[model samples]
Each structure stands twice: as C-alpha cells, then as structure tokens.
Target: MSDVAIVAAGATRFDERIPRRAEELVAEALLEAFDGVKGLSLNEIDTLVTSYFIDARQVAEEWIIQDYIGHIPRAAFRVENGGGSGASAFYTAYSLIKGGLSDVVLVAGWEKMSLYRTLMANELIARGLDVDFDFDVGAIYTACYAMMAVRRMHVYGEREEDFARIAVKNRNNALKNPKGQWKRRITVEDVLESRLIAYPLKVLDCSLISDGAAVLILSSVERAKEITDDPVIVEGIGIGTDTMRLGDRAEITNFPACRVAARRAYRMAGIDDPVRDLDCAEIYDSFDTVELQTYEDLGFVKKGKGVEFIEETEIGGRLPVNMSGGLEGMGHPIGASPIAEIAEIFWQLRGESCNQVDGAERGLVHSHGGAGTAVVVSVLGR
Candidate 1:
C-alpha cells in the first residue's frame, strides 16, 4: 500500500464574525498553505475536497468554493459529518492517494457560522441531535454533555472543578498561539464563575461558535518528497460511530465510538500505549468534559484516572495535549476545526508550531460529531 503524507497545512485565525466570504476565508488559508512550499500550486492539485456543516444555509457552497478557488473544472466535492466533516474529507483524500486514484489532493474546510444569530446557529447545530426526541426535549450539545458530566460525577467522583481545569489549561495555551481565538488568561475559578450554560458546564467550558477555515495538501510519499523536505506522514486513520441518541447507548460515561476508532488507529500505527507513543495530541474539546472523557477512550488514561491527566499531562508533562488550545480556546468552527487540529499537529511534527512541544515526533488528532455519535481518530508521525 502506498503511504500518504501531509505536504502543506494552514488555518485562518479562528474568531467570531469574521468579515469575509466563505470562499475568501478559504483563500486566505490557502495562501498560508502554499507560502513555504516553493513548487506547489493549485493547478497541480488533482482534486479538491471541501467540508462545511450548515449546508441548509447555502446549498452546495462547495461548488461556489470550487469556482472561487480555481478548481472548477477539476474533480471537487463536499463532505458533511457535523464536526467530523474536516477529517472525513481528509480520509477521502487519504484513500484517493493511497488507492492511486489521485497524486495530489487539496482538503479545505470552512464555516460561516457568524452569519446567523447564536440562537439560530445553535438550533442548526442541534439539528444533528435526534430531532424526534433530543431536539424536542431541547437538548443541545452542551446539555447532552452536561448530563454526561453529571453522571461522571456520580460514578467517578469527578467534580465541576475537575472539568474546569481543562478550560484553564487549553485557554492558557491559546495565549501562545497567534492563530488561536481566545487570548484571555483565565483560571479554574474563572471557568466556574463564568456564565452557566448547562449545569456543571459554564460558558468558559464550552467551545466558541466561530467562523474559520483550514487547508492542507496531501500526496503519495514519493510525491511528498518533491513537495517538501519535511513531510508529516499520515500513519494511521480510523473512524467509528454510535447511535445518535445518547439514550440508545448502553452507557453514557464515555464515547464507545472514540475507543473503537482509537483502537483501530493505534493498531494500524503499532501504538501500544498512546501516552507513551504520542508526543502530543489535539483531541476534540467542544466541551471540557469531552476532552477528559476522550483521554480515557483514547487510552491515555484509565476510566477513573481522567483527573490525573488534568493534573499532569500538559506541556512539559508526560504527553502534552491540545497545545494549540483545542476547540475550547482555539475556537470550534465545526467543519474546519479538525483540519485546524491536523494543521497544529503538522507543524508540531515538523518543528514549526508557534507553541512547539520540544522534540515532538508523533501526535494524534480526534474529530468528534454529534453527542459522541461519530468519531475519527488519526495518528501522525514524522
């Protein structure tokens, strides 16, 4: 099988109310993508895979992006799997390259969420919930996660203070990242004292509803050598899903899909233990509890040991996770956030990250959708 490598990657600054068209945001990220790669160009790309969630707002925006980005005539398509859309597009390109159907592929993810009011935008996001039940009950992502947080508290003795630490860590990390959205230095007290969205989950514990774009170029290993001297290899990719309704699952304490996906990716990458094998990670942090739960599902820690992660596994810790601030502080643009995670890992593996982890060589990126219904876990190495 042919190996795939990421030759270029970039992301627009993640923020709310970005004053630019969706295609224009994509164009901005593409500039950073092709900046250092001396010989690459849009014309050389054989395919384009775009990702976005709010398709109902503007039908077939991918075609518009294709035309605006100068890939109108070549093969181009859109991918939507809620928040996992970006990595879904990525794996599409990865398969195309691995299968020899395409030599060079461009994957871009963008979302213009700022176009709608926060309430309407949330309603759009909540569309991913089981409309017949969860939506009717008015259970948004925060509420779904909050219920899980409460269960985690009863079962594992986790506190709101424990989850609040994730917010403190990720937002603090954002201060070092220029492309990250939040720059305010906050504390656990700040997280707890912030406006309460759902019980145990305050405004500070939730990810932002931001507008952004991220781009990456993928190619065969042989072709990767031509693109750049420093190529970050896509070592393994795995995806899994569970029932959309949280009530349908056997348990709600953890995402079964994440564990399944991570196991598959880890097996493919020959990873015996993620904490020992990975130098850093950028997992989904749409909520602070999600990050802690992912730490267990991804095999970084055991079931009740999540707080140990919060206590010890940050930068300069055993395994630095979310050095780019993750969705919590970096901003979650849904479709583009996973690609932004990949961009951060791409830079870290290449020793080019703004907040570089010392001697980093391998990393993991997790893309999550719905109420832990869909997950994509990928392992990256230099």
Candidate 2:
C-alpha cells in the first residue's frame, strides 16, 4: 500500500449563507484547493469521493458534482455514515489509493442545512438513528447526549458547570478563528442561561446548524510531494461502529467505538502515549459533554476520570483537544464537519492556524457519525 497524504486543503467560508447552492460550495472549495496544487488539475483527479446529508432537492453524489461542477470525471461515488460521513469519506479515498485503484483522489464533504426549516432539519437528522427503537422513543440526538450527560454526572460527580466551561473555552478559541461560526466570546453564565434543549444540555451546549463545505486533495505520497512542500501524511487510520440503538450499548459514559478506533490508530502509529506525542487534537463535540467523554475514550485519561483533565491545570491536559473551536463553535454542517476537523489540524501542523497551536507537528482527529454509533480516527504528522 502506498502512503496517502493531503497535499492541499480548502473550504468555503463557513457561514449561514455562502450565496450558493451545495454544488457551488463544493466547486468553490475544490477550486481553492486545485489552485494550490503545483501540477494537479480537475482532470488529474482520478477518484472523487464526497459526503452529503439532507440535500432533498437533488441527488447528492459524486457524479452529480462531476457533471454540474464540470470536473473531468474518472471514478466517483458518495459515502454516507450520518454525521461522521466526512471522515469516513476520507477513509474511503485513502482505501482507494492504498489499493492502487487511483493515483489522485479529491474528497469533499458538503451540507446546505440552512435551506430547510429547523424542525424539518431536526426530523431529517433524527432519521439517522434506528427508526423503530430509538427515534420512536423520542430519542433525538441531543436527548441521547443529555441522558449520557446525566449518567456521567451521577457516576463521576461531574457538574453542569464543567460542560459550560467546555463551551466557554471552545467559544473563546473561536473568537480567534475567522472561519468559525460563533466568534463572539461568551461566559459560563451565558451558556448556563441559554435555553435548555434537553434537561442538562442547553442550546449553547449543542453545535450550531450551519451550511458549509470542506475539500481535501489526497494523493499517493510521491504524488503529494510533487504537488506541495508541506503535505500532511496520513500516518494511521481506524474506524469502528457500535450498536446503533443507544439503549443497546452497555454504558453511555464513554464510547467504545471511539476507544476501539483510537486504539487501532495508536497501534498503527506506534504511539504509546497520545498525550505526550500528539501535539493537538480535533474531536467531535456535538455536545460539550461528548468532548469531555472523548478525553477518556481516546486514552487521554483513565475511564471516568476525563472530567478531572478539564478541571486541573496540567502541562499536557489531555492532548489540547479541539483547538478548532470544535463543532460547537466551528459550525457543524453535518457532512462537512469531519473534513473541517482535519482542515483545522492541517493548519495547526503547518503553523498557519489563525488560532494556531504552538509548535504542533502531529495531531489527531476524531469524528462521530450518529450519536456514538459510528466513528473514525486519523492521525496526521508533518
């Protein structure tokens, strides 16, 4: 298998409106990336992989992009894995290159969610869950996170303030990021006072429903080095799936799929200590408590001890998680989110993050598809 590396990455300005449809947003991102490639063109891209969810108006597939965006089509397809679809799409592209089926692959993740009513979009998102068992029992995504947060508090003595602090810190980080959706800083009081969507989960605790798209150009390492000087190598990739129905899982405190996927990535990367080796991280933070739980599941801390990592001031506080402002402030455009996570890490490693991590050389990114049912982990190094 050949090494896969990201040579160029681009995204449309993450906003509620980009004055364009989903295909146009995708073309913008791809064109931005294509401009940076030294010897690559839309015609050179042999494989095209994209992710899209809730685009009810038209078919959201790679061929649709090829014809509408006027790209020279070679081979293409769409990947659907709920919210984590972006990362899963990257994995698919990597597999294509690894198997020697394609020399250059363009991966794009997009969603134009603001086009629909909030309630209608909510209903569409709710469909990602098991319809008969989970959705039928009023198990909306936020509601599942609320139940997990409640259990986490009961078992680990976590405070609602801890979740609020996560929101406060990520939002503060977003202020430095021009591309982030929620750039204004907010206090813990602001988060606490926000309307409660679920029992302990407030509107502030949840990720924003925004429209955005991100694109990454991945090629074999040889082809990548030919295109760009600073290529982020895909050192390791891992994916895992758990029980789709939240009630079927044994515990809600931590995601087993995340642990399994992270373990696989660490093993492949030969990483014994993620906290010491990894410079920064971007994890799915659809909810504040999800970030906290991720610290434990990803081996930043012991099981049920993730809350302490957030409270205590330590040198390596669980891998500097979510320098991107995460999904909460970074804007979660469903399918576009996971690719955006990788894009932020790419900036950090290159010392180009407007809100850059100091001297970051290696980073990890994790994305969850639906609730905690599907997950993908990837480690990238300079």
lDDT by residue for model 1 (161-226), tens = 999999999999999999889989999899989999989889999998899999999999998898
Residue-by-residue lDDT tens digits, candidate 2, 1-382: 8988998888876776566778788888888887777977678889888998775766745676778766654777889999999999999999999999988988899888888888888888999988988888777888988999999989999988989988887777777777788868899999999998998999999888889989998999988878988899888889988998877889988899999999888888888998888988898999999989988888888988876787531214546777768888878898899999998888788888877767889999999988888899999998
State the C-alpha lDDT per candidate: 0.91, 0.85
Best by lDDT: 1
User: What is residue 215's positional error in candidate 2, in angstroms?
Assistant: 0.4
Total clashes, candidate 2?
1
User: TM-scores, in order shown?
Assistant: 0.99, 0.96
Worst 10 residues of 2 by lDDT: 311-320
Top TM-score model: 1
Q: Look at candidate 2 and give me any clashing residue pairs.
A: 84-369
